[model samples]
Target: MQSLFERIDRLNGKYNALVSLDRPRALQRAREADLAQARGQSWGPLHGVPITVKDSFRTAGLRTTAGYAPLRDSVPDRDADAVARLKNAGAIVIGKSNCAPLCSDLQTRNDIFGTTGNPWEAGRTAGGSSGGEAAAVALGLSPLGLGSDSGGSIRVPASYCGVYGFKPSIGKIARDGLIPPLGDPAREDSLTVVGAIARSVRDLALSYSILSGEPYGIDAAPQHAPRIAWTGEFPRQLMDDEVSSALEAAYRTLSDSGASVEKVEPPLDLHFLNFKYFMLNMYEFSPRESSPGLHKLFWLFESARSVFSGGIEANYKKLKADQREQVDLFDRFAQQFDCWALPATPTAAFHHQKSGRPIPIRHRGKSKRYSYWHATGGFAFLANFLGCPSVAIPIGRDRNGLPIGIQVVGRREQDTALLRTAAHIAERIGSTMPLAT
Candidate 1:
């Protein structure tokens, strides 16, 4: 356990995945854990394990700035609910990981910690806002990471970094200690969820069990092989050739391995989902950011725009009807398959671009202009959009030798079963893609 601290000292400078250190406190706790184990006392499953939490989630004595400059000195008196659970199970909080400012951007960069580079390649982004957590886990800085997924924060990073990330249903974990407290936590966190990132499916399962207070069998077996409905095609978008081909290979490998893998057009309509995700996400967070000076005015303008774009309580309630319809459609469609699988992103990690600019598609003969949000979250939004549980598992590397992955989603609130199915697939397919290093 102490070696991890030494590793942090040796390697964190290059990856910049971890932003803070609780070395003394964490080492002390690890020693205690070792003593307890010697006496045959166990705190729980994660005893003696060291982990990191995204800076967005507060840790009692650790500074949590959420990668925003103004909150650089902010430290909480209590851990976020999920972080507390991990500690209760004997997981030591080694440090906090870097993230995009205020958790608003899709790539990990801030004036505070600089940036978290992809472990697989130099200059490529470790997809954010869970970028640091994913990269940290991938690089062995931590065995597991606590992150949040609202608009693909967890999925994108896991896909880009060749790790496993599980985003449970929204109500699974409380949102009491988010860096910037949610305006009306229960409601505002509707689309966001606490998630776990790890190097193996079992780690995700174990972390999920501890975080959500639900049992996730690390080697749980299915009565029968899971039936999967998967696709590599997205409506109105062209997947980069390498990614599309990697997914196709995964589909074939899974089919040959005995899981009932079938290709079909899912009920997922990226066109409708992308817009709804934008409006609903805006309604959830638009006015909550109160950065001062120009930033404050910018958010104020956003609030006004929300009002003009239908953000009143009445309009929110109206959107609920749309939400209900979409949920129903997914629920109905999901009845035929045990789970759904698809590409986590259109492509593997790309070189860092100007923070909010559009990135054109990379496939030959295709030049559709795509926003950073669309490129990364087009497929990922479906899980958060319908409030479903999804797991991102690295399948293999793309032509660039960067990792590519798939997101397997299951029914909302049925998290354990989804992990089991994903684990089963992971085992059969060997989730043995090469390490980033």
Candidate 2:
């Protein structure tokens, strides 16, 4: 059997998943882990496992660019809170994976390191923001990896690559070291979160447990089976045939498994949701005065548009406004059931170039526009905006053989139930196929 380091080295170039591989350090850690196991010393659940982190994470002594040119040489002096947690669990940090510029786009291509393609189909995109981590995990370059989801970053990649991704409720996991750390530091926001990407839903739960300091803490309660509201449409928006088909199949499987599944046409405004997300995301990038170039142009243009449309305040304010409204909506929505279900993305993995611009897509007698090209994450964003937990599990596949995933969303601080539901789905449908290393 090849060591994890060897496996990574053997497949790193094939997927372009990693921007920097810590070979010397990784080998050293593996050797230490081997020695510890030989002595019968134990660390934790993640002991001896090699993992990867998205480049946005601050890993001590390793370059973390967030895929920006100015930060290309930047290295953190300390690990982010999540990184420290995984390290404490005895997980080896092998390397940092690629990401979009400032982690703003849907595709993982930036001037600093170029692109990271899907392991399933080399010609297709792996999905963004967290695309690199998803690709790495899908290819078995790492069994588990950390990726942040500020609007479907983690789940999108996981869905596109046939892996598991989980975005826990805001504040359930510490946000102390997250990039652009939360303003309140302790308060959780709807748009930003640190999540995991893995080969199995069980792996996702395990990683979350270790990172959150709660072993086996994810609620796997059968009694908490939620009154699921399945929507093939994008909230109030449209959907694609591929997306609709995947969601329909997942609903059927869940219904077959004895879950209380129902279809509800809730009064939701998806176009506003898309615009709200664009406003907030653009505002996020505008403040980063670093990396002067097209990126600055990209942020400034969107930021200005948001300001002109909603008033020239700030992105944080716009996000807060949208979130406040979403919270109100959820407060009312919570009375009905435990959670909502939706397609993680309208379609499976596509060529990277096609995701470069926002466009309109149709599904189930609805036609709507996405404000940003990489707006496939529209459905998943609502859960994040409401500070709720959600897990993405592989459902089935499309005509082109791409993986389709279903998102199980729950109330804030209800991460345990969310993971449990996802695990249930995985157990029923069977987990997505694993990548060969």
The estimated TM-scores of all candidates read 0.93, 0.87
Pairs in steric clash, model 2 = 219-416, 357-373, 358-373
Against the true structure, whose TM-score is highest?
Answer: 1
Candidate 2: tens digits of C-alpha lDDT, residues 1-437 = 14666777688787789998777887888888889999999878788788999998989998888887778898889999999999999898989999887777677888888888888788888888899999998888888899988888898888888888998877667755666541333333446888899888788888888777665854544766657777666444555777787677767887898877788765366667666765555544322443347557865775777766775455456567866887778767765766677778876776767444655555556665554443467676666566678888887777877888888787777676667766766777745685734
Clashes of each: 0, 3
Distance from true location, Cα of 98 in model 2, Å? 0.5
lDDT digits (tens) for residues 302-366 of candidate 1: 56766777755656676677887899999998888888998888888988887767766767566
Q: Which TM-score value belongs to model 2?
A: 0.87
